[model samples]
Target: MFTNDTPRQGLLGRFVAGLARTRQGLAGQIGRLFGANVPSAEDLEALEEALIAADFGPALAQQLMTPLHQRLSRRDLSNLDQVEAALKRGILDILSGVAPPPSTMDHQTRPQVLLFLGINGSGKTTTIGKLASRLITEGGRVVLAGADTFRAAAIEQLGLWGQRVGADVICHQAGADPSAVVFDAVQAACSRGASHLLIDTAGRLHTKRNLMEELKKIQRVVSRQMPDAPHERIMVLDATSGLNALVQARHFHEAVGLTGLILTKLDGTAKGGVVVAIADQLKLPITFVGLGEGVDDLQPFVPETFTDALFARS
Candidate 1:
């Protein structure tokens, strides 16, 4: 867990840096919309364009400015700082209620299963490895299950992460039953009394019929082994994908309930405002955000800093 007391550097530092970049990108757009003496309507339009450009989605972007427009219309238009403050408040309101990650995620139980599900190229496997490393650093034993039997490299990649993190990995040859792999992994974790078990499933397009069915089967098998296993079902989203990320979130929710979101590749895209769009539309809390490629790049989502990073002056 990232606390406000962590001094805001390194992993948190890079995250703050990324937020600054995103805010700069957004602010540049808003600044361009108006000149020396801006009218109230012009400021409102400028703010809307700024947010939309940041990937807040048009509907949400406009909704955010509703109150801001009212204030701007009546407030002293002589102060640009006032405009900035109103814009910040509007953006903050949309995300103020973004829920925090579950308090029960302290991983007190042995073999706490986390099912990592996402389409290919969404960085699911890498995220799992990083999470495992984090758990280990926090004094938890981790076991990884390579249930992504569809791709040979997928299993290999997970094994490599296991080796790097010094966690046990369970995987069969390619094309084996994904469910069996998970079943065996759970049994092993139970026997070894591992603190956590992170399962890596095959990354399939949401459109794949057979692949999705296989994923469900894996979930059922885990439940049968341990009725309360897979305590967390995390859906990884590629932040660079824009609104299509929303489509993937909905599809995955329909396929299997998502407890929260793990947004990856945020450092690679300035469209981080998609986070707001997702929260407004899905109401699924974003538990983590990946700012870079390092093993420690992941950070728990912080709404205040996130708002400042997007709309606050750099």
Candidate 2:
């Protein structure tokens, strides 16, 4: 169970701190350009350049500049505060459009299966561990399925997480068939009456057709046992990958149908603006963000908090 001392304020503070680099790169630049002076055309151009530099992508940068351009054309002289507010509104608009719907899992389905997808080194294993910890704290009986039999180390790593989180781990030997592993895991979960079954599959590059097909096969195996199984198919994205992350999301969503995204390594990267690009272009809701290395650092994504963090005063 989560400790009572884990205050809401603390989590929000962490969210802000994790976004420090991004805010510095984005809001810091804007602040220097518009501080105390009415932003001129050159200032606005520099602001747009900063947005693009922060990984907002060219398209989103243009959209964010639209209101500024309109205000400038109208000669609506505005203070730095007004410019900041306009920028915030623009970012919030993009994020809010792709806000996720409330999550609901049918209790009748027995073990609610959640399948995680991402390329290697995208932190899929760590995300699963963090999620398992959260679910267990919420009083749910959880089981982890190590379907990443391609890597013995992955199987071992998941086993360690299962032990740490006090959840059962269903795994097969290295080089074993991943689909077969899932087949057994579903049966185990059903028999044990687990509330949640978290499946960790082998990480493969999005460009690998065979690996993608393997993912589809695993999905098929799960559905055959429980028609509504694999209740959520979430793609874990490495935020530091910038535009490459967007490409990976697109391909994976096309291949296996992603229900949401979990962006990891947010704290270490300055290109956090990729969050906006991903939401605006793909329209995929970001469900959670990995803020730090701690087990509890993976918090549910809140657009308002994120926007506030990005534009936070120095």
Query: Would you estimate the TM-scores of all the predictions?
Result: 0.91, 0.94
Q: Number of clashes in model 1?
A: 1
Whole-model lDDT, model 1: 0.79
CA lDDT of each prediction against the hidden true structure: 0.79, 0.86
Q: Write the per-residue lDDT of candidate 1 for residues 1-314, one digit (tens) a residue.
A: 22332344443456667666566767687766545565568767877787788788999988887866776667656556666676667656666666564363665566788898888989899999888887788777889999988888989999999999888999999989889999999999999989888899887735567767887898899899888878888899999897889998898888888878889998888788898999889887788788877787777777766766555443
RMSD of each candidate relative to the true structure? 2.4, 2.4
User: What would the per-residue lDDT of candidate 2 be over residues 159-184, giving only the tens digit for each residue?
Assistant: 99999989999999999999999999
Looking at candidate 2, the ten consecutive residues that score lowest on lDDT are: 1-10
Give candidate 2 regions above 4 Å deviation. Answer: 1-8, 101-108, 205-207
Per-prediction backbone clash count: 1, 0
The numbered model that scores best in lDDT is: 2
Cα-based RMSD of candidate 1: 2.4
**Where does model 1 exceed 4 Å of error?**
1-6, 9-12, 32-39, 76-78, 101-104, 205-207, 312-314
